[model samples]
Target chain A: MTTPAMMYVHDWRAWQPGRRDTSQPRLSVAEKPAGGHVPAMLRRRLTGIGRALCDMLAELDVDADCPLLYASRHGDGERTLEMLDSLAEEAPLSPARFGLSVHNAIPGVYSIGRGNRRTQQAIAASGDEFAALLVEARGYLAQGEPAVIVAFAEQAIPARFTAHFTTPVDTAAVALRVSLTPAQDAWALTPRPLTSDDTAESRPQPSDLIDWLCGIRDELHCHRPRQAWSLVRAE
Target chain B: MTSELEQELKHLIIDTLELEDVTPEDIDPDEPLFVEGLGLDSIDALELGLALQKRYGIKLEADSDETRHHFRNLRTLAALVEERRTA
Candidate 1:
């Protein structure tokens, strides 16, 4: 018999920087990353998204070597825009800019800076990326990994592409330390395949995870379009 | 005239590249900008190019092989800007 998926969300943190207003479509991030907690060499090289990701990673309670998975709907939109601008202007693209424009750039920098050689994944999905991350985290728990960290950071779409999205996105990141061992007040997550009846209203927000982390919500049912993932408070 | 442009170039490099720890006086006029001397990489070079274009109204040819030679050091960069400045 196969062991059922059992995982405990040990700790989580949320950091949202920049103006809350989504009308202004410019890239804004925290002026300083974790108040310089990140090493200067790495910090200097990091883009705004990378800095935000590192800041969220610093707030995580997990070990430095823990496996990490990062998810986002739009990862490094500013850098990507800059690359496009360079291309349009017929300018040579900088090697460093191209390197940081990749979706996995933040995790790769974190791995190298902390000397972590474990496996890491960068995920990008159309909608409800946070839900996808939770589902992925549960899968990791099923494989007997002691713990995993899922960090997500994304910003508002650039002004050029604002027409493409209906929801006003903001610059935010959430880091969850999902563990195998259940502790007091841990939320147990069980994911089931979704049916047609389950709609978009059940979709999870970044704030929902924050509410669960802060003990405000007893349970959270994070849903994707066709995924019926649910989290319940362990009794 | 050359020394003044070189000094101005040094300050521009420090400001535009965000070399927080280094000062204008710290960068040598003849030191290589990449790999060994000032430790700037290709991104810095691109940013510096843009800044120079904005400040000095200079045009940089991306396909020109001589562009790399101009970016070799602060002195070379200042000379190129001086020679090419339209405004």
Candidate 2:
């Protein structure tokens, strides 16, 4: 039997390079890399994907003590590529780039921006990133965390590594505040088994995915190499 | 040393660290650049060292007090650049 919704979504925001904030007036890409939360010192050093993630974060009104979960299929690809290139050239690697190339780098920066020291986790499960993140959320809610902020993003692979990836990697970032007992309608995840008709690689682009998250879409099913789950809108 | 070299060093520091709000004039040569004046942390120290190495071909004694002395401020950094730069 499908279990009850393990968690609820309180609020969410999804960001793209040229996308506009419907809540605010027109803001150019140049104008929206970071909001007032990120200081100039930190903002100046953000990569493009980092910028998108930070911009999405600024829209979230999370508590100072709220836990955070950052999930990405490929984390910090550009910075990792730069460090690799530096190593190949036998040159000293940029310390900043090296430090930011780690999986939890952007979330660490966000913690600094918000002075948040709550329990934080970063996940990089191959194709089931979001699903696995929700599983973590379910754990947090089960353990009595009032809420958890979920941040997910993926950027285009660097030119040298583009040929390694078969699918067109779309750049996007999404932030969501999930709680156990939310004021709004809650969502549930039902574990599913993969089928021959599985459309894993051919999933909708990020923009459409964001729209699906916002609106009432059909059951969103995602399958990894070894596992699968269906996100259902349980009313 | 000429003021021009010190000014160049200031610009280098600002650019390398991505200190968006600070201008060369804002950084006092005598003030501590770490933890007090410019408020740079340990990561900034390593980043600055790497930038100096890339731009000037200068190698730092990674754990030496002498290296720390050279990174004292703008004047000290420029002095190291003047003495050690190959490019």
Candidate 3:
């Protein structure tokens, strides 16, 4: 019997900084005005960085109908900072802010916006967020449901917390749309580290891996950030 | 002329609202308090109202149309607080 199919992919920066490939550019925070088509209530508190990620997923055709697995290394750092700052000053926390400060808020918002009721898994690991998510997606694939995995990582944090970890200069979001089809481009499930290096010697970062899969680039070098994850056909 | 009342009000706004990007001086007395102004939402109104009652010993009548008028802006909120403080 053929092994079940599992795919891993990534999308970095929703909107392009300049004219580039087919990857759609991300929208600015200011662009997300009140009552926009994007489920405004669910996303009002998201920072520009967070909103950029949601926009990227929406652009990639991630709808509520699809099963999704969302993984984030450091989820909602800005909200965490705000809450901690208020608590430190002996100020009453804003209820709205407190509600959205949870680690699952990113996936929660995306699910609500897309009206997706499918099972969604949200996880935050010390450094194995990507690996953990890939394993989860494999589980779904084994269960016989096509899985769409979105893995995102953002390094923007308050300096108080930044001093503890390696400072990430940029942010990224990557998504993959995976399904079983009669094609040879299926991705094999493998456990590995989340690396920033894109060299062939080093395993490709999620973003570079998707780029290579899409044939956008032959290879990506080290230092390129990896973002969201998804499944795509190998051409 | 920073009266104790004004200072109290400023402290209340800063503390109750959790306005991180805002300081007491940054809030203009006449600025609209919601939407185009400080961008406070409906949830903020509820929490601020609760704080006002507990901290200032003022019972803001929920049904009164005056409640909306009183919460229109900081100046109005301050006026209500001043009126209640004296009474």
DockQ of each: 0.23, 0.82, 0.20
Q: Which tens-of-lDDT digit does each residue in A1-235 have in candidate 2?
A: 7666556777677766665544432122343555456776777677766776665665664456778898888887777887787889998787777777888988888888878888889888775777778788888888988778888788877777878886666677777888878464556445556788777663434454565575546656655555478999999
Reproduced native contacts, each prediction = 0.12, 0.88, 0.29
Q: What TM-score does model 1 achieve against the real structure?
A: 0.73
Rank order (by TM-score, best first): 2, 1, 3
Instruction: State the local distance difference test value for candidate 2.
Output: 0.74
Which regions of candidate 2 are displaced past 4 Å? A1-3, A20-32, A58-61, A185-208, A216-219, A224-235
In angstroms, give how far residue B73 of model 3 lies from its true place. Answer: 14
* Residues A87-186 of candidate 1: C-alpha lDDT, one tens digit per residue: 9999767556676778898898887766778879999877688777877877887787788998877777788878776677766667778887878866
**What is the number of backbone collisions in each predicted candidate, taken in the order shown?**
0, 0, 24
How well does candidate 1 reproduce the true complex, by DockQ?
A: 0.23
User: What order do candidates take by DockQ, descending?
Assistant: 2, 1, 3
Off by over 4 Å in 1: A1-5, A18-35, A45-49, A59-63, A89-95, A192-197, A215-217, A227-235, B30-32, B35-37, B42-87
Cα lDDT tens digits, model 3, A1-235, are 5644345343332322222455433323233323233454345556554565566556555555666677666777767888898899987676767877777776677667767687877777655555566667767877887556555544345567767765342344556655443345444443344465444234333444445545678643332235688899999
